[model samples]
Target: MDKTAGEYHFTRLETVVFGAGKVESLGRELSRRGSNRALIVTGKTLGRSKLLDKVKSAAGSALAGVFTGAEQHVPSHTVNELVAEARRVGADSMVSFGGGSPIDTVKNAAWQLMGGRAGSRTIDFSAGAAESGRGGDILHIAIPTTLSAGEFTPGGGVTNESTKVKGGVADPRLQAKVVILDPALTIETPAWLWASTGMRALDHAVEGSYSTRHQLVTDTLATKAIELLNAHLLPSLQMHGDDELEHRMRCQLAAWLSIFGMSNTRGGISHALGHQIGPMWNVPHGVTSCITLPHVMRFMAEVAADRFGPIAQGFDLRFDPRSPRSSAVECADRIAKFIGKFEVPTRLRDVGVPREEISRIAGTVLEEVKRANTVGVEVTLEQLVGILDAAY
Candidate 1:
């Protein structure tokens, strides 16, 4: 297939290793990067996990200190603390050992270590564009325990404490030099959180495939990701003991592929809505994605109809392109039903989002995240309210 003009200009993570026990190689990987001093970053719960202890033991003398204060949304105060800890330990490098939150925290710390500033000043998404400039040297490694796929991208989300809003920091310098994907680490993840985040990864793949910026390369990756999630996500959620490994590995692969496509094509309304609602309600990022995903698909169905048929086929749904809108609607409804099988809440109210706050959430999205999306849909604040109302 002939490539679209300008679509070939893209950058991706340096190294990605995927397997059941690949995390055991982290010690040697860090050594290879010429780092003897490492700062381990993770959330409080994951910091205490045996998997993290194994990483610490594997690093042995190379591990300088463990900072266990990483939060759900990367708060500016937490970033300040993590950066100080990194400096206090005289750490030469860092490792993010959990899901999106820890990964995001570590990425922001890396950016700060490289001279990026953070303060009361809010990022204007409209004017903020990522540049390819190299910053100060600090090697970073990511070991993702959840399947949100933030480990695979050059962007990171950090919340401003004062305003309580999540803003993205996009810099190639924040990309992990080495990524270790071990399904073993995922076993300890809470089932609801795992399944919900897996759905978020699926959302990334689905939205990226239809993005106006998508190319053939991204489309292929997105299609395969959707297929893998279709075949494996539910089974993964229900597995126990030895059966868990294969399912988790498949979920990890799906997450990787989703971000591989998304980095090239970005995401659409689901993510934009999630970003809007997450900070306000303290909703889990994945839960936000899960609740809003189907609604976003229904809204975008008119323009994204051609892309929906492949997604339907991936899930073994009987698809007729002649009825693209209905086929897409079926795909969305199927996903919602699949998600309902888990402990995740299907409705906005189920997650504690009140009716009155819907418009406020819409306002935040229109003011913050919508500028970064290139969906060609021309979403207005009222349209966002309609989505929230429907989900509510």
Candidate 2:
């Protein structure tokens, strides 16, 4: 897999403070960025958690205000409210708390916050150029408690509230200036959520390694992430052990590695399908990965089987060089088995998705496939429904 001629792109993230109790540095991090007024944004339930209180205490006087309007799926209306709140409080920077939803909420709002005049620094996707402008961007700090790795990337998925179609924004300027990966902050995250999001990170690693745009650097990072998550994700949920925090920290590092080079390599069909399925059915993105990733991998194996060897190897399974298709199937089976170890819903039916919705989901995914044109493989509606049926 040595490719001599490929570009390696990096995001705008600068600092990552990793370890226990690192959230204590939030105020200092804001000071280093020269931000006087920062708004704290998170989802509704976390606002009532003791974790938010820790964030507030650490942010101290630098926090201008709190906005808890961040919802699952990142609705456009909620982003609009966050934009107004950011402006209303005269914020110089923002802090995203909780999981993917809040992190993406701040990222999508950055376009409107920057007013398109400052983003001349440019975006990989042309959409950012139209919506976010060029340059003069104010970056935010991301303190994630879940293993969902959206904070590591510049792009974010935004759901259209009226239609519930998930769209996105990809401006490098919207990338977090700083990411705090403190295990202490994640202690309160539910075990099921942690395990499921760990699968989401694993999906990142799997999809990144075989993506059409895969490069040497990302393959190294992504495969290592796969191994680390396999080894540490479940241990992070230890009911009684001093090792739990350490394991959680390792999982956090794995999550970051999973998406380190996302600017250059977007995930393939598993993610594309999940992007649509997650918002429409109100399933969490991680749970959607549980439902779709293995089936998607099996479907992609005919064309992309050779790429599955490393993933199988990551999970300590034997990968046959002579039989790449079977090896890919084994890899997919390993992933499914790992996901089953957790309590999260593993089938579309388990998550309340009706059998009647498979056609609708397939149609929506087909429309997305037509629009993106980079699924790494051509897929038809029948194949999608077949995969959905297997998951169902």
Candidate 3:
């Protein structure tokens, strides 16, 4: 194997506060950002949790209002509604209080409200949009309570209700101004959600490692992320002993590392399919990964076997060193076992996705992949359907 130093750029939130109780620093962080009016965006469940109250107490009078209307897939209408809420509250800054949904909602809504672009839902990442001027100037503080790493990336997925297809947008401004990773805030997250989103983070690392633009640095982070998630996710889900917080924090760190250099690369078919299936079938991104990642890994194994070596090692899957394809298959097998251990649906049928919808999902994915050209592998309608068929 030939090795050469490759170039890649790393971008991240302006500030990141990571610890057990760093959520308490929200007010001071907001003040430091010169934000006086903050609107909290979250889902209904978290809205009612004492977690929101903790954020409220931290924000004090600086908290202008709260909007708990965030939903799965971030429907465009929701973004429009949240924009109205932001306007009504005169919120100078926003805090995303849930997982990917709320964080995505805040980024898209803020982008539109702050005069970036309306109807910019279909993110053409192939055009290098992340390096362009398309997002807003709105200040966003992301306090993620789940393992979804939406806060770390500028890409936001928004669903069109009428079409039931999710599109994405990428711009640097959509990246949160600050991100607070406090494991305490995640204590109330449902076990299934924590486990599923842990899969989502695992997907990020797996996909990032084999991304067409994968860099040495990003690959290193992605590999370590896989190790951390594989080691800690189950224990975190089991929530054993006083060290459970440490497990959660490590998972959070894994989530961050999973996408650390994603700005320079993009996830392959699993994510592409997830972006479309998420809105079409109303499945969460993590669930999409549960149904798709292993299948996609198998599909890509023929062409990208070498790329799976680190992931195989991360999972401690022993394979014949002479056959990279066998190693890749072992990697996929390990992922399936890991996902199954959580007792989550690892098949489309298990998730209630109609078998008939496979073609439609493939068609949609084909169009998006053709248009964006961001998928790492050469994808065709047949290949997409084949992947879906295997998942089914």
Candidate 1 residue-wise lDDT, 1-392, digit = tens:
65547644444367888788787788888888789999999999987778888778867778999999999878877888999999999999999999899898887888788887665233332221355465765788899988898887777888877677777676766778888998888888998889899889888888877677777777777778889988888888787776878988988999988878565566677887787578777888899888999888887786677677656766778877677888888888887777777788878999888888688756667754455565676788788888889999
What is the TM-score of candidate 3? Answer: 0.95
**lDDT tens digits, residues 187-293, model 3?**
98888889889999999889887777787788888889999999999998776655899999999999999988777767678888898877888788888899999
Which residues of candidate 2, in runs, are more than 4 Å off?
1-3, 116-135, 370-375
Q: Candidates 2 and 3: which is better by lDDT?
A: 3
RMSD of 2: 3.1
lDDT digits (tens) for residues 34-106 of candidate 2:
8889999999889999889999999988889999999998888888899889989998998999999999889
The per-prediction tally of clashing pairs is: 0, 8, 1
lDDT of each: 0.79, 0.83, 0.84
- Clash-forming residue pairs, model 3: 123-168
Worst 10 residues of 2 by lDDT: 117-126
Residue 268 shift from truth in candidate 2, angstroms: 0.9
Q: TM-score ranking from best to worst?
A: 3, 1, 2
RMSD to true structure for each model, in Å:
2.3, 3.1, 1.9
Question: Candidate 3, which segments miss by more than 4 Å at Cα?
Answer: 1-5, 126-136, 318-322, 371-377
